[model samples]
Target: MIRTATPADVPVIHAMVRELAEYEKALDEARATEEQLREALFGERPAAFAHIAETEDGEPVGFALWFLNFSTWRGVHGIYLEDLYVRPDRRGGGHGKALLTELARICVERGYERLEWSVLDWNEPSIAFYRSLGALPQDEWTVFRLTDGALGALGAPTR
Candidate 1:
């Protein structure tokens, strides 16, 4: 069963995040602390939300963390999935697909124009799974980011 995550789930979410990072070969970069996650998810003004998938007996298996984005061209809001992970041992049992299905349902219900996420170029298994869901890749788009010192410098006052 899939349900919206609560404050009580922060630790589990944080752990799964680390597990995901490990799977992606970037565990060293998983810097989010439990307090940070709790604040982000349950703060007075939340910036994002998450859903957890649990076994029938109530064991957590996976999660989908996402936020809403505005598209000027479409003039509508869309769901931007930041992370989606299913435990390695629990994969192949439809948990991943089920999580996505729930996200799709949220989009349709809220009149969102699109649901999107990025997968590593080398993640063939994930790519195949997304394709099986009829998700198309935005080949024309290239993702760029500014972070740490670069991000700070860009936002600094002109001298």
Candidate 2:
């Protein structure tokens, strides 16, 4: 079962984030704290959203975290999935698809023009799974990120 996340799900979601990072061979980069996640997901004015996938017994197994991005050309807002993770032990049970299906449902219901995300090229398993769901890779697009020092430097005021 998939349901919208609540404040109580923050810790588990954060843990799954770390687990995902570890799987991606970048555990050190998963530095988000539970408080930060809680604030982002359930803050007074939230800019992000999350959904939790649970087993029939209600044990959380995976989560999807996303935010909205506007497509000026399409004149509509789309969902940019920031993270999607399912515990290794819980994979292949359709939880991942269920999570994504819910997101797709939201996009269709809200008149969104797109649902998008990035995956590491080396993650063949995930790539295949996404492809199986009819998700197309944006091979023509290159992703660039300005983070940490680069971000701060560019945003810093010049004298």
Candidate 3:
């Protein structure tokens, strides 16, 4: 079952975040603390929305984090998925597609113009799965990010 996450789900979410980071070879970059996560998604002003996929026996198998973005050109809200993960052993059971489909439902409910996310170029399997779901990759755009290390190396004076 897919449901919105609550503050009570923080512990499991934290653990899953670490697990996902490890899977992506980014364990060291998993910097979220339980308190931080709790405050972000469950705080007075929610930073984002999160959902967990659990089984009939009540074991969480996957999660997805997303937020809304405004697109001026489209003149509508877009559902931007920041992260989606399922345990490697639990994959091939349709959990991923179910999660994505749920997100699509949310978009329709909210009248969102788009549902979008980025996938690592080398993750061919995921690319194929997304393509099968009728998602097209924007080959014309390049994604860029600013890392803390990169910022530090810039030697800008602190406030």
For model 3, state the Cα shift of residue 120 in Å. 0.8
The global C-alpha lDDT for each of the candidates, from Candidate 1 onward, is: 0.96, 0.96, 0.89
- Candidate 1 contains a number of clashing pairs equal to 0
Worst 10 residues of 2 by lDDT: 38-47
Model 3 over residues 43-113: C-alpha lDDT tens digits? 99988888888888888899898899999999999999988988888898888898898999999998998
Q: How far is 69's C-alpha from truth in model 1 (Å)?
A: 0.4
In model 3, the worst 10-residue window by lDDT is 150-159
For residue 69, give model 2's deviation from the true position in Å: 0.5
TM-score for all predictions? 0.98, 0.98, 0.92
**How many backbone overlaps does candidate 2 show?**
0
TM-score of 1: 0.98
Residue pairs whose backbone atoms clash in candidate 3: none
> By descending lDDT, how would the candidates be arranged?
2, 1, 3
Scored by Cα lDDT, where does model 1 land?
0.96
